[model samples]
Target: MTAHQNGNISAEVSDFLLNCFARSPGWQLWLSLPLSLFLLLAMGANTTLLITIWLEASLHEPMYYLLSIITLLDLVLCLTVIPKVLAIFWFDLRSISFFACFLQMYIMNCFYAMESCTFMIMAYDLYVAICHPLRYTSIITEQFVIKAVIFILARNVLPILPIPILSAQLHYCGRNAIENCICTNMSVSRLSSDDVTINRLYQFIGGWIMLGSDLILIFLSYTFILRAVLKLKAEGAVAKALSTCGSHFILLLFFSTILLVFVFTLVAKKKVSSDVTVLLNVLHHVIPAALNPIIYGVRTQEIKQGIQRLFMKGW
Candidate 1:
């Protein structure tokens, strides 16, 4: 009955929602297939990473020690949601149960925060090892990392619980189809007719604070690391330092992009083309998860040899 700007009658919110959900394009097939390939590869690579890191005592040193922990976290993180996320493309579950979506949101957010904390710890570890090599043993001890790891374990899960918990209380009397495949908090929020002011504010503030803090710390750490790497006169020593930090740098950038872009995009209402959305999800999860193992394996030669040794011995 109401006329719209284009001389068309204004459609109900529900109709718009249906259009967004149903308009998945043909090119999504391309996105979904490759993502599945990468996901499977990530699973296997992460398994090897876990086994190899635990088997070698040489890897138990402070530097490799932090690296091993990251491998484990990456495995847990990727496996926790990417499988279900991929499942959405195949299953036409246009609507997700409220509880299920909240659970997914909680899990995804928890890992996102955990990775942020991990990055900060990693930057500090490198700052000490490279910047203060003489005191590396004393400064970056096993005890220091253990405490930080414990704190991160507790801290990451604690903050995100609020958002999902609050969301579970909202009633949905209407449309529930998720536009994109995954069950992100934004999708759940869109379903609610009640005031989402609190949830939106929390997401914007909490998400940015976590991502900004980690990134700032990483920048500062690298500043000091670069200064130290430059002071080293030996080409061989400089190469070694660069090699170690280089992989971590690349991996950090990869993870940061995936986590930040996905979280930040929640506010945008424009329906992402199915292909683009799937591609975003794939690169966000698959490539980062797969690239992580490669970064660790290639940069740390010992890991490659250790994994080979492990396979040979098992045989």
Candidate 2:
């Protein structure tokens, strides 16, 4: 009946019971309210942004195209993780089939990596616009966008395909309880009866490579952008240049900070409570998704005008 003894006999785990915020069951119902609100806001804001972009011909430029990709990724990421979390909170439905769990894990990993890569691309776009203004149009043309999209999809999806496959091959045995909201590779792999060294190592190494490189490139892009902006002799040029990148920097900072906090909390697990870690992990997904469209809508004038036009037409 014990976990190890059960594991010794069988290697197949049909389903998994997610241990989603089990410590404070009383607060879960109340917690679901805000989480549900975040999900609703993320879906609504991103959808409106997408629709506005689609309907407005003026917004068909390369920058908006990249924004559209970000919007779609946010929508997909939110859809992948939030509904199941809501179900766990509201109905106490935490059981997920082995296959479904792996699928969710795959989607989460792939979309998150895609989102990070997209942010790097967006930073590069900003750099080219600010640093190499003359070449911006020619460099970031439709063809270039198409190529970048292909790279994003291939780079993120291909490497992540093996994650779920490797996880599926593991001997899960009777340890079916996962100690988090989503079906992350680490969380599920921890339940395996077989050695999880490879899984842990892969996740650690892959995450650092993907996210680390993107962050470094994004930082370098902004560095050059800052250098270019500083060279302007015009009086208001600095403010104008900063304003253009303000929203992007804000969102990027929030995105990176929350992720860093989650990683640090995981490292300092003894100092942090499980509930706090779980809350951080859950919020990192939805909070960015909810705020991204709103930031771009309010900060970017083109998007604002597009929204107005969309509403006027609707009326």
Candidate 3:
């Protein structure tokens, strides 16, 4: 046990060794290639989306502004987790400073919560557009988007801030080897000598309360939208409404599926390999980020035109 004291706190492990599929050393090369591709794809796609939105004045609206927020969140998540994982896989630089680990954990928790909130707000925007078309312009204004962004940050940061804080406060007097690629609350807290029942409970309960509520609200919004769309007697009205919400539905489905898969793998650890869980956890950070902008770009006509215009201008 290497004791390194920082300020008032004494720690046996000053840095954490990430055990990212270390048992199968040969697989690291194979894993590193795809991870690197994913990182590039995510960075490129999100950067393009942000630039396109910024350059195109016509695309400036509540929906696009909210999309920019989601894009930013995805960029943050990918940057927070993937680069370190790649370093671990490729260069075998697995040791992460104690402070860095906790910072990554905080970013993972807080930004994910913020993304969920942003999605819920986007759902509300859809609900307003579909269920009450007349009120949408008035309801989802520039001021409304600004307030929603404020709420998203405040709601997530305040609640999730305690998770890493609580985990970091624990005394780590034992092993510093984290079984996963990233510093998750459970993995980091479990390494501590202190009892982490509170940390686990708060992580579980707080996560559920935040995500669960968002899911429920999103569901309610879509339900109303579906009902309203079905009631439309005008020709192409149903198709138009469906088209309007389809991209968001697809993105939400992908996000929720990834989240569910991670949760399931975590719960079924006995049946699933630790390597698979870790891989899924790492992929969770990159895959959605890499795909979100693509999904939006393909689905939204304005974004496609904006991209075309951007290319033409550059050429």
The global C-alpha lDDT for each of the candidates, from Candidate 1 onward, is 0.71, 0.86, 0.87
TM-score of each: 0.86, 0.95, 0.95
Candidate 2 lDDT score at position 41: 99
Tens digits of per-residue lDDT, candidate 2, 242-272, equal: 9989988987886796468658766988987
Off by over 4 Å in 1: 1-21, 91-95, 259-278
| Candidate 2, run of 10 with poorest lDDT | 1-10
Highest lDDT against the true fold, candidate? 3
lDDT digits (tens) for residues 1-315 of candidate 1: 222222233232221111123465554455568868888888888888877778877777766767766777777667765676555557633344445667777877887788778888888988888998898888888898798889888887788888888766665544445566566666667766778888878876898888788999999999999998999998699888988788889989888786556644553436544545444654676678888888888777888899889899992
Weakest 10 consecutive residues, lDDT, candidate 3? 1-10
Give the alpha carbon lDDT tens digit for every residue of 1-315 in model 3: 453322233546778888888556677789889889989999999999999999999999999999999999999999999999888877878888988999999999999989999999999999999998888899999999989988997898888988989998988765777888899997888778888999899988988888899999999999999999989999999999999999899889867865686588768989867787777788889999999999999989999999999999992
TM-score for candidate 3, please give it.
Answer: 0.95
User: Residue 140: error of model 3 in Å?
Assistant: 0.6
